[model samples]
Target: LVKPIELWTGKQLFSVLLRPHANMRVYVNLTVREKNYSKSGETMCPNDGFVYFRNSELICGQLGKATLGNGNKDGLYSILLRDYNAYAAAACMNKLAKLSARWIGNHGFSIGIDDVQPGGRLNENKRARILEGYGKCDELIQSYNKGMLKLQPGCDAAPTLEAHISSFLNNTRETPAKVCMEELHWRNSPLTMSQCGSKGSPIN
Candidate 1:
């Protein structure tokens, strides 16, 4: 049975994998494909590449390239993780998470490490670095949220809307059900019922 482990940084998701000693030889197949989608939602040009990594003090991958049909370079790529130890594997995952948050941002896709968990044990320094990296990612998310809230009209008009909504709710709380229904119908629609209603319309 294959169990997939995932880690979420504020900006991107990383999947990690770990295996036993007998399957130590690790190969990461990196496939590059065109971002252009056909009418049927299929990729136009898909090319293959490979990277080899093994257990050691310094963990790294040896890059290998693949040829495209039109002799042009591949634009988008995916990383496939395979056969890795716990320590080296977790390190690889943390590195990918950091890179995705700092460099890739929202434009790039997520990376997956084949067989590792988010809470997997690692060296002290490595763990610290990963935590620090994710903390920065959280800050980015918070900044984005604040920017989006400022762009919202409801937030901009919150002071007036809050007063209107509070008054309407408080007045309606003890009103009879039949009277409330009659008032709702007389208003024709919720949008025209109160000044706050139109501005507070749900997006979806």
Candidate 2:
């Protein structure tokens, strides 16, 4: 009853979770250090990619594992338990479960054919990467067959070729993941989920 506006969006419900009462407040920063984000302060980020909470209100950044995940010693739940008590943290978790369930139920999420389909550029780059990997493996195989392959410190020629081929193929998989991540739109549902560290990864 104290709040002015009628809550309609999932965001409105989230704000209430952040500021349950008028007196309680939290100030937090959980933005990652990367291309556009500065380590000093994220307040100046143009894309609002930085996570900052001021006066118990979420001012910027997407809510992701950095804020909600357990591994972080300074995550939201950890902060709540530290400042208040275990009960406070548990209560907040309960709120999250209910809110997420209801919100997702109301607005369903899915991965369409368009979501997984790669663009022309990505396909071309991926093909090139695969060919490069195969080329390296072929070179190693030819050396081994000719008995000209250099041996590892404790490994024989066959083992050395296998090791080199394995490493190159691993990169063949990893590089395309980075390219795919760059090619997808920020708003794409699967991409959003992966970026948030909720489920799936760039490789998936």
Candidate 3:
């Protein structure tokens, strides 16, 4: 008779989905978690909050869209398909869909304005970054109008100016987004939803 193995934690259950057999191995790297873990030498969260999965088991990290989303080729679904086969990925997806439905039936979830609205230090950082980016953009615009803008490779002054401005704006946007994530509590509804890949991404 086959002995039943009990999964005592969600991480164990996830590992089972990825590596049903002892011979199977899955390596996952959640960049966001890794970045934070690397800071202040807190890599060992001791509660499975690590950015990496050692032997397909989450030892110390939270799962996020980077691992779960369909947007990337390195996502769990993609990894399953690549390391095993399409059938494996499909089977995993079916289980996930069913489990998610069951979970929803017993849970109530919502995102209120309070959950995402910037406040205090987060708002100050956002405004400061925007002002800095705007000033740089204005400088670039002034240069372009005066025909003193540096042209990008294979691009004219206007395109070069636009490219630089866009890059600055994007960095500006990302700065606040990062600050916002840091300011929000880990248990914050929107943040948790973003981290778990049950809804929108962290940037959203």
Candidate 4:
């Protein structure tokens, strides 16, 4: 007679014991595939398995099959806040970052990821939102007046406008429009809307 098995370890013992053989084999194979691919696609089968794994890794990092991970996720902002080159570093982030054709003046936004897009994610919609949110332009102007060093992480830091823009963009997701508007307003002209009023539309 078979000995009674002790199921004390809190493992899913019943499921393991009664698992169907054919489905069990398929599940095992899938697990093996996951393991093999995760470890740099080493044990992947010949023909397409290695290729598929390699391409998937290249595209998604660890974000499963969707490449960009569901929707406009926060991972890109995380990467940017870490002081990475947004364009080059986008590869490591969730793959949704994309550049737009409408240029942000000479700088040309080094915006989103994905090989398909080229201009770097700037557009009229983004621009409009940015413009609308940054109602108070004098604050940044004041910071510039009081020495940008105060805004830096430490006493010795001297961040450029570009660097400050990057940090602001990353952290200001709720006000992405405002942050962007600030970037545009701050970077271009000395006179803000407050300073110039109706005539002070900086883009003009």
Candidate 5:
């Protein structure tokens, strides 16, 4: 049976958590500080920050910032948030693995772990091209964004921009327009292929 734990808030909880105990006195007090982006008074910009953790036993740190790209325009902030979340998750998994290793022999339990890589940086040239392509299709993009505003989480909606491009290309038999649509589709697709055709020729 577990004893009832006292609940405290704000300064009371802080004092309780921070105060040293008789058996194991606090040896270090580590605080992970993050910059407050609200103080900057900027709009539609990435909030850069750092994270660090230190205890009596170990210290680990990381610094990162958000990125904006055509790849995930819907959830731009998630690009950076995912990295920090992955780092925290990895740290927790490491601690769990160590604990599991100690209990393996006696408890007949083992743990397996997988690798986690950080997100890739957006390529400047590719980004520029994607932006240029979007610039050409401003009306389409605006319509797509408006449609997206109406979509709910589980709505059975078709691929917005891809479908639009496909229809546009089908309707317009112009070779140059078809090439532009193909380039846009290729840029947005998950497959890693060159934006250009054979021998580095421009799509146009």
Candidate 6:
């Protein structure tokens, strides 16, 4: 069976490996022959490069229609992280969560180690430094734990960023669904890496 095309003019090559009277494997490879030109007879190199979904969910939706359970779980993260530079990854992590003092430094930014762990909580000094770099206030991070961060009037709920993640954690029994999956050590999950990046890359 052939895979569905997603509006690409490239030549796609597919190959399948099958054993006699046994299971089979199907693989589809897509490669662009050349740039698609415009009506002016000039080669038009698209600035967008290729047409692809932004996230893993969209890619899974497309592949699942043709073949069930074809896409990998962290494929999206792999792609995004591969393209991200060091600066981009650090910015993304900061916006996602107030780094628990443990994940500071090493991103071309100097941070005091005295305020990122259990014994080294985010004190006023470290908090100021992080806030200055990330453009976020320390009060905002504190609001996450306290019952202060509100969305609408009279509604005591976490901020949009925090709430979005908390909802996913609740669904998965407090275990992270995607990014933090490897970092967390569950019942059977062994301690593997020290700290994984937001885009599924290793941090140090």
TM-score of each: 0.18, 0.73, 0.60, 0.23, 0.16, 0.17
Query: Which stretches of model 5 miss by more than 4 angstroms?
Result: 1-21, 33-97, 100-136, 140-204
Candidate 5: C-alpha RMSD to true structure equals 19.6
Candidate 6: Cα lDDT at 106: 36
lDDT of 4 at 165: 53
The per-residue C-alpha lDDT of model 6 at residue 60 equals: 11
Give lDDT per model, in order. 0.33, 0.74, 0.69, 0.33, 0.35, 0.30
| Predicted candidate 3 versus true structure: per-residue lDDT over 50-86, tens digit per residue | 4455656655555665566746775667766887788
- Decide which is better by TM-score, 1 or 4: 4
| TM-score, prediction 4 | 0.23
lDDT of 4 by residue, 96-197 (tens): 322212234435533233311212243554565566436323455466668753454542334554465555554444444333334443323322322223
44-111 in candidate 1: lDDT tens per residue?
A: 21211121223321122111222112322331122222333455545655665576487556554332
The regions of model 6 sitting more than 4 angstroms off are 1-137, 141-154, 157-204
Error of 2 at 109 (Å): 1.1
- The most accurate candidate by lDDT is 2
Clashing pairs in 1: 15-113, 16-113, 16-115, 16-116, 17-113, 17-114, 17-115, 17-116, 18-115
Cα deviation of 125, candidate 2, in Å: 1.5
Cα lDDT of model 2 by residue, 1-204, tens digit? 236966543445556886677776543334332222335557666544466666456655556777777367767788778877887778778989998888789987778999999999889989999889888888889999999999989999878888888888988998888889888997689987877778788789
Alpha-carbon deviation at 189 in model 6, angstroms: 19
Assess the local accuracy of residue 10 in candidate 2 as a C-alpha lDDT between 0 and 100: 40
Q: Write the per-residue lDDT of candidate 5 for residues 112-169, one digit (tens) a residue.
A: 2311111223234445556655664676667676775234355433465656656664
> What lDDT does model 6 reach?
0.30
Candidate 2 residue pairs in clash (backbone atoms < 3 Å): none
